[model samples]
Target: MSSAFRNRRIPTILVALAAISAFCVGCSDSEDESDSTTTTTTRSAEGADALTPFVGTVHFPPVPFAGSDGKNHLVYELSVTNFTSGKTTLDSLQVIDADSGAVIDDLDAAEAHQRLQPAGSRDSADSLEAGESGTIFLHVTLDESVAVPKNVVHKVTTTAEAAPPDLRTSTAEVGPTKIDSRTLPVLSSPLRGERFIAADGCCDASRHTRAILPVNGQTFVAQRYAIDYEQADDQLRIFTGEPTDPKSYFIFGEDVLAAADGTVVGTRNDLPEQVPGTFPSGISLDAADGNYVVLDIGNGFFINYAHMQPGSVRVKLGDKVSTGDVLGLVGNTGNSVAPHLHFHVMDGPSPLASQGLPYLNDKFSITGQVASTADFDRSEGTGIPLVTVPGLQTTEHSDQLVMDQNIVTFG
Candidate 1:
């Protein structure tokens, strides 16, 4: 296939996550890891901390949010650094409630490796050399019967290749963090329709959840809560004709609505629509969001809408908008690979420099779900019908967040 027509996911880029700080032992770098990249915590003065060879901490204190599955989920990233002088292998990880000493969750080496990824690299994270760092993308779900913990810690077990005979294997309690107590913004749907797909959204999706990037000397996870919304026809078709034409997609020229009451803080409307099917190359950092709108929704939170149709933006800077206001029309613009509405909530107005915030939709229903992200991509690339999972009930959801690969209907 020609390079321009080759299928590539939208907004792909290389990023290096910052090393987390907690149990910094046998430290090599003198600089502090407490910059804007990670959440800073006070180190323990206990004697047992001196024996730990791995440093770890969370990027942000996670807020528990309800999902369409009727479970409370804690979604966040954990960064760890092997501060030992030799190679170290991660054996297991267990999440523990620091206040009650109760174990919340446990993962074996194989499962942990799937969730762990080295900074700026996609290699296996089962082993780490000296000074190597990796981030574990965590998605902990709790049943309605269980109570949410106020604080949590990680019990990490590892083995060092160069350690003395009696000290080769060790376990350490690291990455102490308190749960975020702030309230999540209850959002309205960004579009009103059926067969809407939440692509590259929430929880375990690496395309958005682990998209940590460095900007202006600090690393931030602006896309952590992002969701690319696309629509499909009754036959589960995302596009009917030429894949390269934005007009061929089901969601093309659809109205993009404001998710909340907010004032427009930023606007861009001059960029032309990008051809669908293949990812655009050489997109500058500034134009990656193309023809976008940023809304200041109060309490230091902002709503970002990207990949809008050229000349379709209805709101300008400083214009006050209410829920369900039409901001623009969805189009294949900027760094997009298709015509879809890219929506997210951030702590600041700057798209790339802000931290993502958790949120929930006021009402929606799960009519179905795509079998997987790969299946959705196949339908997008080949113009085949979406591969859906059977036996799923058409369940109604209210005040819950839609997860990745969900086929929802909002009104």
Candidate 2:
């Protein structure tokens, strides 16, 4: 491929993930007696087979996708194991900017998965076996038109098995955005040049809208929530070479601070973390979200935080908080990554009883173009930093909830 085309086309594929915490999807203490030491070959895009590196062995089928730049991309899942025992260190896995060597995640694509890997696998064929078992989630984008490099490092690793943390009492509490203000608050910036409503948990852009926040400010936008499998299971979620290197992928139980302040109205903190996988073997035995919380933000509105670290929650159901408070670090106790905060805003006391509402933050900025359905050309600078992209602002006197209709006045 020409340097220019390769530079322009592929990086968008890298930044598209949303959230990939850590989890232990396929971990086993099985005994392996295979001493053959003979190399096994797997086929590549070019129809050529090669000996497998213990680190990059993949068994899941490839997922076909279309990129924001209008090219076909493929994502895959695989099992990885640490044979040497003790530990292994993964490094040098990166997706670089064609020209400046800068890295960014492929979050600009609306269809991106929070983490790579499909919903299921064929008998866990793609998993790594430590002596017998271990695992990881892999995201890949391939262009048949681009030359197939013989020794290309599609993936890399440095350790045997990364373990999940025991978060018996972790919790996270999200705060409220200013509804009675003219400005729209910062909801999410999945990656640079990528920001959107926290309404639909899915990455579908069609589901995105400026209307997520209400004009009357009487209520907040409705939000969709889902169980993040990786965190729930204790497998590390890694983003491939955008804005950073592949080595940057990580394990779970990292800290997740409170996004807002309020009294804790509800809490569920006794679920054990699961192993990573879409349909984890024993998933049906557990509730969708293992551990969660709902904070009473005064009035009828409550900030719903889900998938918290088990037992790490500092506050009781009635605890009070301020902005930036350390409610709890991230964890894979619920439907989650090894550890990450799954948050949203709703009108009722419980996730099931409340309706998702639009909201704004007290402080923050949007870093991408506010896309409208009328024009596809609106999206630009996927990885570039966006500042002062006009939308809304807040102030002391003009305190009224901003709605979707007001976007025109601000734009």
Candidate 3:
């Protein structure tokens, strides 16, 4: 529950006056009485005249996951739009435990600015203009031992010039509504006997693939647990000799395989690969995903393998593919910075227009990890000695989620 006062008593005289005004408006002869009556009733019931200044929706996976860090993680986003006629300031937003009314997390103005999507960040004004909408990313991690909340609340505060500060709040019921966890296919390394670094995997804070994309007039919160895999040598070098040549990287043209038994639902293999060191200018949405494949792994789950080489896809739509089946060859296409495989699991066949769900791998050996991209880049560009920490020596991960920067080899 929100601490702010939300329900104010309406004076009897004002109610009577409003009713009389509605009656007068209804009797105008040009307007329908039913329309006038319904409008008045709706306004009074919702207190629309005493506007909240903001309106929006929030979404999250129903079943939360205990991530690699051993914490129950909740990833959600709030799409907020200013409804007030004038500019309004969004002071703060908070995630609250509905049952105990405990404040779970609070996002102040500066923190909110940092979480806003790219379009929202472009606004130079401090206040949101009327009808302007923005998205706020919220990631909450709780003790793994604690039970996940069945319901959550969102409390927001905003202010306008003449009106009193409004405390607008909403509640949503959450449960294990997401797809049930299944044993992910023990996907063989797309590149056999070669070590690859997990650039962004599972639930990492710096993983922008987890960001919500507002597409086709719909709020698509997909790619929440996507992974970007790049090949790295023993020295942690991503590229050798010539940096501009795609062939210089070890991952280019590597065989891509099906992670599980599934039917191919979609694929694109006509897009040309971009130059190794530079991103293509003015990339369109359809071309952004690059050459890709969407496989239906049954039970409403779809696996996406993206950035495959042109003219290399061996499977077609509706083709049944088995685990480890050669589907295509990896290439730099779409919105790729270089040659890498972008993999993720979603609920829909439409690659970018679905909800991303968490998945677990059967087994893999963790060899090492790169601390940061800066270190990885320096090692690749300047040949500086890269520091590598020995991981869980040849250990097998059973039904465990992969983490960021993990250099792993599949059994």
Candidate 4:
């Protein structure tokens, strides 16, 4: 459980208050004075928290890192529960720099609705019923000129006329968490070639970063920092000939390199390749990362290279590998829709259960950017040239996580 979840206390006093609070939402102004309920309460002792209408906790402390956009990003979620007895409408939120008293970001109601998804539904919403839970997806970017904060907190305010007239505009402090300061691993390139596109990658992309799954009774975003690398030719085409043929891809059978020196902890080399053009049907969860390898890259970090060519994995379990060593060849396999390398650094050996962590490429050159995921998909699915943002500078970057849609060259 998150620390914030454990710290919130609602004893008997709040339980009685919750019931009265519910009745008070629909109570008329002419109701007897004796039936009125008090909504505010404060403890007399110093540092004691008073009762509040909502509770929120951050499931994972974000590790701030610089991205290809040349800015520092803090990407994480705030899990919340409505403690009020009446329906609560989220008004707005302000992410504050708890130490410097600086306002980091202000999300209006519409923006909140776009990012806030309820517990069970995939769609986003801005309101929750009494005792309901939801999650707020947040992506905070700090400009290159600004300093990153050591800690951050949220100010959650509900809509006016929500309940208990006096508490209509109440603001509560929630999800205060210390920022993780550990340095992200600087890794060598996992692939070698020009025009290697960083698709469905970090910061705000939906396909990878927003892929949250409930596994073993806990929720995890294993692909939060994952990058699906696909290559394009000089004509900006993902494949030249038959789309179904794995050999048609520019990166097919290319060597997959170890990003860091580490001992092989887990591996699979027998899963057959899936046909390109669409996702395979009915893949079990255990086979999601088909013919893959996991490396313990020291300090509790594991790197996963998934969807490799069947029988191409060169390293076995317990085999020690060094940076730039050949691990396998990229292939279309497992839950994959096409031939691309699915790569990510996780906190655990099991790719599905661990939280994703950020990593920096030791060096790489940016070549271009795909206009959008749709454009890349269309070009990959059909034999069309990829739509790209023109005139991107081909410059080498050092020690930064690549962002979404960027076409890069690796050594």
User: Which number leads on TM-score?
Assistant: 1
TM-score of 2: 0.34
lDDT of 3 by residue, 218-302 (tens): 7676787788887777666776777777677777888888877899999998998888777788999888889999999887778
- Candidate lDDT (C-alpha), each: 0.82, 0.34, 0.65, 0.82
lDDT of 2 by residue, 312-407 (tens): 667777888765565654555554322334565556776654454434433323222223322211111122221223554432212122221111
- How badly does each model clash, as a count of residue pairs? 0, 77, 0, 0
lDDT of 1 by residue, 252-292 (tens): 99999999999999999989999898889999988998899
Name model 2 segments beyond 4 Å from true.
Answer: 1-222, 225-251, 279-286, 337-339, 365-411
Model 4 global lDDT (CA atoms, 0 to 1): 0.82
Residue 197's C-alpha lDDT in candidate 3? 71
* Candidate 3 residue 304 C-alpha distance from true site, Å: 1.2
lDDT for predicted candidate 3 compared with the true structure? 0.65
TM-score of 1: 0.87
Better of 3 and 4 by lDDT: 4
**How many pairs of residues collide in model 3?**
0
